[model samples]
Target: MDTSALNEALAFKSYDKIADICDNLMLQVASEGVAFQDEWPYAVHLLGHIYINDINSARFLWKKIPVAVKEGQPELQAVWEIGQRVWMKDYGGVHEAIREFSWSAQTQGIVAAFSELYTKRMFELLVSAYSTISIQDTAVFLGMTEEDAANYAVQRGWTVDSESQTMTVRKHKVATEQKLDPSKLQRLTEYVFQLEH
Candidate 1:
């Protein structure tokens, strides 16, 4: 099957199309026991950049590159370097690589993927830093309406306020059984409360 379609989809910024192709590629590679052969490395590289989104998984795939190929192709090494930086949450390094890495027309999607990944990491950091975030802050960060921000946060288990100014994590009540051991239950309750924060 022609998995190169993923490359084209990525170049055009049709990233949503990449997942199925990568899945199919994985199945095909698994069924055939294809290791480091016939564009498998490139496909894995694409998965690393565009789909896997984890340092260890991508690094695992990267190690499968044939020694000869790893040494012979400069672009492969370059791609690996760029992908590792992205996986490491080094957005500034990625931005510098975008300008400095010799990107051919065929590889333009790597830039887009890196940019999206960096933005996603930034958003994750921004959200994680706050227990209670205002709708205005959410709207500004996401470029959406306050209502949309509240809706989004609510869907993700955050509680929208009466004034709709902030979204806090929804706290669940601990239902303790009176019959259970009191000491163990108190410790469990304390652990649960600690996790909420």
Candidate 2:
């Protein structure tokens, strides 16, 4: 496996190419079997790295790796842990886990830029998941003051209760028009709302 080449691509953040490589590897696995002992787990981990900010993709990739391989590589397991932490809305835990996870010389190059990128993404995820979060937690996570957090939250269409110093995310309502089923309706109105097929 040309880990150097893969690492280089990841270091440069060429996600499309990384995704292409992952697709090709998975195709090869399907056609034959594990071409190399290490390739399967490595490809899955690379995908996890590509989707460091995306927990669902990270989890899907984690499940794609065989259980035995997951045991052999704790770091790969750590990657999944990062994703899980994000999913649980533990932004601080995500950052802490990211920092605690070991980065090999091979991995360091690829994952170096992920710290800040991942941290910001975790913050965004937390804001989306929690209607209210402690102002201190927001301040610590964002490295900003409560007032700044309030400003940022409001800009993102969220509300903050000043007295309580809690942030609240405003949910966007999905707009849908009520359309009577033509088959169910006994008679069609003169003006019927017809969806574009």
Candidate 3:
């Protein structure tokens, strides 16, 4: 199978479209009755799922990969390590895995993208879930050094108590309650009445 398209997609950081591209290519390979020759595409496809925060899909893909391919390709194994960390909600492990692996040029962009997205997600979760959090925990969650995490919290308008080494999160303002649509409610009531009758 020609890999130019997959390479092109990676070059442009088109992560969202990678699964579709790989699926179509797999189909094409199957239709032609040829075995998969390259392992890089599989690695890219798996990382693409990770980039989109689709752990289940990434797990499914991992299961589908042949054992030999999984064993032979360290990059693929590294990608799966990140997926495992994500599945376990081991944020520190995720950062550690990303840092420890020597990612190839082709997969680097998607891995970096996933790292940034995951950190952003953790930041949002911390903001919503914590009134105040310790700098060490925030550093682990944000995949940053303690000093960098402290600075990041301050930059985001969070108040850091230097003596306590804790940062007060800036909570988002809760939106006012949305007005229910009368027509939808009336239809639902009529449906319930009809069902009861």
Candidate 4:
């Protein structure tokens, strides 16, 4: 299988494009009645879905993979383990799976990118959901050490009480400005005038 396109996509960190590329490749190969010469593409394609947090799609992809191919590629299996953890909404397990894998050079970049993106998303969610939360829980949620989590909170303008071991989330107020379109306002005014008449 020619992986140049996929490799190029990975080089650009265009993770969202990977699924489409792999799907097209698989379809073309299937139409030609040929088996994949390599299985790594399947793994990368699944990781692409996972990176996008499309757990449903990742689960579907895993279900469609041939058992032989899945078994033959430990890296693929490792990716699936992360997908499974994600499916179960197991944040800590997701980090554990990532840490346990000895990913090949081909897959390492995407894996690292996924880890960074997942941590960022978790941080945003925690900030919105919790006003004050335990440092240990924050560590687990963000896949960081307690000290690191505390430090990260502090950097984000959150306050950490050393005695209580809890961090207070700093919520920034968003300013909303509603702008009305002139055409729409005029149409609405005309309609109201007609109704009054």
TM-scores across all candidates?
0.50, 0.56, 0.86, 0.87
lDDT of 2 by residue, 1-197 (tens): 34554556666776435645655656766677546656554634553445545556666667777788788987776766666776786666766766787776645644555655664565666656777887777766754566776676678787777788787767557689999898667444433544322
Model 4, 63-83: lDDT tens digits are 888888888889899999999
Which ranges in model 1 have alpha carbons more than 4 Å from their true place?
A: 4-8, 16-20, 26-44, 47-52, 127-197
Clashing pairs in 4: none
Name the weakest run of 10 consecutive residues (lDDT summed) in model 3: 35-44
Displacement of residue 2 (Cα, Å) in model 4 is 3.4
lDDT of the candidates, in the order given = 0.62, 0.63, 0.88, 0.88
In candidate 1, list every pair of residues with a backbone clash.
none
Per-residue CA lDDT of candidate 1, range 45-146, in tens? 554444446556557656866787777766666777767666766655555555566666655665556556655554565566777877777665543467
Which pairs clash (backbone N, Cα, C closer than 3 Å) in model 2?
none
- lDDT per residue (tens digit) for residues 161-194 in model 3: 9999999999988989989999999999999999
Off by over 4 Å in 4: 37-40, 179-197
Better lDDT candidate (1, 4): 4
Residue runs of model 2 more than 4 Å from their true location after superposition: 1-8, 15-17, 41-52, 122-135, 143-197
In model 3, how large is the Cα lDDT of residue 132? 96
| Runs off by more than 4 Å, candidate 3 | 37-40, 177-197
